[model samples]
Target: MKRRTFLGSVAAAGVGAAVAPGLLAPAVAQAATYKKRVTGADLDTNSRWQVAGTDLGIPYVLENGSIGYLFGDTFNSPWPEQQNNDWRSPVMLRSAVHPGEAGGIVFDSAAKVAGNGRAPEIMHNGHNGIGIDNLWEVTVIPNDGISFPETGRQLVSYMSIEHWNPGPRYSLWKSRYAGLAYTDNGNDFVRTNLKWFNDADNADPFQMWTMQRDGDWVYVFSVRSGRQDGPMMLRRVPWEQLFDPAAYQGWGWNGSNWGWGRPCSPILNGRFGEPSVRRLGDGTWVMAYLNCATGNIVTRRANTPDSAWNNEKIQVTFAQEPSLYGGFIHPWSGAGANELHLMVSKWTHGPAGNSTAYHVSQYVGSV
Candidate 1:
């Protein structure tokens, strides 16, 4: 994902980069207010997704049934003729269990790239080969099966530009907020954004997790910002306090932030992203996420979501080919039985592009 390539395409297309309008319009804003309480029980895995227009990629499910996803679409918007190289990234949505119920907000990237260039651009721009588009947010209401509302309302939208030879080249663009939703809109929802690390010469992909370990409180686990040193940057925020505007900043832990106790192996050293956290019936929290290019799914456990985590282990390895990108884990019930399941996307070549699928594996007890 070179910065020059991304910005060059944007400039070449001559599309004006404009800031997003304020919140929802009056009519839609009024509609946005809901008296009905949307609960976790309203979300289900058995529900299917209808093809909401495949502009670039396929959509997959996030932990449990709270989120759905699509990625890698390559067509330019506002005008279909100007096609950039097919360098699409991940897109996700909030979903409901019942057929025609309303879910939460959706988030996605708006960038593309092709061919090789300079290592400088790649390092400086943080995976320069990939370009992100202005992030968009959508509200979903199921229509029978997988069919959803075709149009999505805009939340925070912005594009990234790469500093270049002439001036700042619009290399990478991003929306202010990634599409994430919470029920109360109080402390349950947290606001965060991506920032480029010029000193590290790479972009860190941040992952967010919300888990309930003991009582009713939810714990927020953020992978903070990642460098080459591995996914050691870990932070915990009380769920009830995260939504405060000022509390959202500086959540990363300070210190070594790596190592394993006697019972656990040394934590892998590298960047990590796409984290999924779930609580087992016995009251243990299990966290799983990808470690950089290795594409290995690693797990860690903690008695309380905010307590120090331990027992880091590799759950699955995709050494042969890295088909599993941006994955999530959840418990699924079917035919009177329930088991742990993983949903991942298979990157396709040629015209088909990409599609997501689910893999079911029994929960053999968490460490």
Candidate 2:
């Protein structure tokens, strides 16, 4: 999730090491903005993540009206005081819950939901076999798209193994190959069908950030450049072809038309976090992401998924919380001044002092 990893020249097939940056026009003042509303909502559970653990940030409220919360390595508290939020379990966690009508959430402490177990295997070196293979995020697309089943499925993004060493020459641990893990009923995923498109030479070798339906096509928000601390790129494919690489189209600012199978262009500059996008009530698309440098969750609005966006507002900051990111907006948040709910994961100051916590916490209210 750091920015410096995208340094070396890519060896992709014909895409070249240098992709021309799309120049942005002079800015205009924006009207739609954000204001801090909800801080956080904590959960009560034990060490096994039967109820508690960190790394529970990326979430998808299922079409069947349940919440599917995806998490990375979970922290297993060693002490009886569940608040002792220290120590981590090497495996991933997928916790689910039924949203209550009263605005509170309750997850079953007994439900057998074991997230992606162990590391990734498809063409991954994992820092020469030492990095952790993790699935960074998950997306749930309705089955209405073409060639898809009548029932919706989840598209989980995979992050190959990598070592974490933050500093100059941070390209030591690079994410080479990432792809999607398909799921039918939201919880159970088909492990054998894992498909990956290598990002070694291309711009976006990771999961296409957050994807949303923009009219007839599903717009994919992806990160490349510095991987995390990089511009947000745009890609689109018809609803029925969301998983078809050949059907994908990249935004061509100069041509003003989508160039099918062409290279992607930077749509948003600066270090934007993993973006969570949704179509607003007025038809404009709004994306919520952490401004990594500032440690604040910001929102941006655009007329179309692939258009220039106006910086809306900074909603929440990590003044006390520290590494709080993964601002995932709830699908039920329907436009206008209605309340916006974010499923955010923050790195708490651990028991051993400053170690980053990987717990997924929830925040309610609006922007």
What lDDT does each candidate get? 0.29, 0.46
Please give each candidate's TM-score.
0.42, 0.67
The TM-score measured for candidate 2 stands at 0.67
The alpha-carbon lDDT assigned to residue 331 of candidate 1 equals 27
For candidate 2, write residues 1-367 as lDDT tens digits.
2212211222211111213343333223322222322112233344224333444345454445444444443334422124544323222222343221344444442213443222221122232334333543221211111112345765555544333333222222334444455556544444333445435433453443577765578777766422244456777888776567778787754565545456776666654456688775567676786555555666766787755676446566565345666677755555555356566666554566444344554555443
lDDT of 1 by residue, 149-216 (tens): 21121111112223322222221222222223331221121113433222223233332223332342
lDDT of 2 at 350: 52
Candidate 1 regions exceeding 4 Å error are: 1-216, 224-232, 248-269, 306-312, 319-321, 331-338, 350-367
RMSD of 1: 17.3
